[model samples]
Target: MRGNLATSLRRRRRRCPIAQYDRLPPELRRWLAQAALPWSPVSALRLWHKLLDETAGNIEAARQRLDLIEARMLMRDAPRIWGVPPTVPPRQPSPAG
Candidate 1:
């Protein structure tokens, strides 16, 4: 029983990371999986660049949150409904037609 439990744990650890990768937005997940299974050198490199671009976007989002913290912004200071744009729409299209 104990041996089986340990084996299950090991499998879970390996599966968790891949599962997390699967949870990523569709485009990133596709590139990441294909990057792991490279067909050609050029393809691998291109996938790496695509992954980097995705990470860069996430980094920018983190930087924005950090900026808010640095400015001593509190909960109320931040707007509700994350991913929703403010008055200028913050890179998002306006709700109106």
Candidate 2:
């Protein structure tokens, strides 16, 4: 899977097409390098292109969201909690009325 922090840390990753990778701003390049997905470039590159269009090319903020998600995933260790505990009926008054 892509964006696995541990594997990325152990590998020296290069995005396919060095020129394209080189053209990215330094910080974005660093982030991608760290993210290092195991996916094929065809899909991921095309998806990123589409996302850039969808977000109007706000790359930095998207990267920030990625980082936030990654951090939260790392910290997540339990099932998610939900609102509204179940209600139980009060016991009826015993033999009296």
Candidate 3:
């Protein structure tokens, strides 16, 4: 079964020579990110396979785009906590002996 799946994937690659996610256009990558939502193990695997098949030819470019998208997403989603100074109690003087 695994062999059959592999063969099927190979056939698909031959039919569509486009590179993997690493080679995809920024627009396409963004589309993929949207498609990949509702994160679950199964969804992740499907997304991974899609990316792998799509990026097989243009791995480097796809990877670069993916990285850029990830960085942007991280920056957008970063926490926005306000700055606050810590308050420490004053040290008590030692009692005379």
Off by over 4 Å in 1: 1-15, 36-97
Candidate 1 global CA lDDT score = 0.46
TM agreement with the true structure for every prediction? 0.22, 0.35, 0.29
Candidate 2, 5-67: lDDT as tens digits: 657356777756766666665655676778734333444456566666767888876676656
Query: Which candidate number maximizes lDDT?
Result: 2
User: Could you give candidate 1's per-residue lDDT for residues 1-97 as a string of tens digits?
Assistant: 5667656445533345445555555544444454423233343335445545755856445334334433453344445625434565367666996
Report every candidate's CA lDDT.
0.46, 0.60, 0.52
Greater-TM-score candidate between 1 and 3: 3
Candidate 2 positional error at 13, Å: 23
The predicted structure with the larger TM-score, 2 or 3, is 2
Error of 3 at 46 (Å): 6.2
- Give the C-alpha miss distance for residue 85 in model 1, angstroms: 50
Looking at candidate 3, the ten consecutive residues that score lowest on lDDT are 12-21
Return the lDDT, model 2, position 68. 65
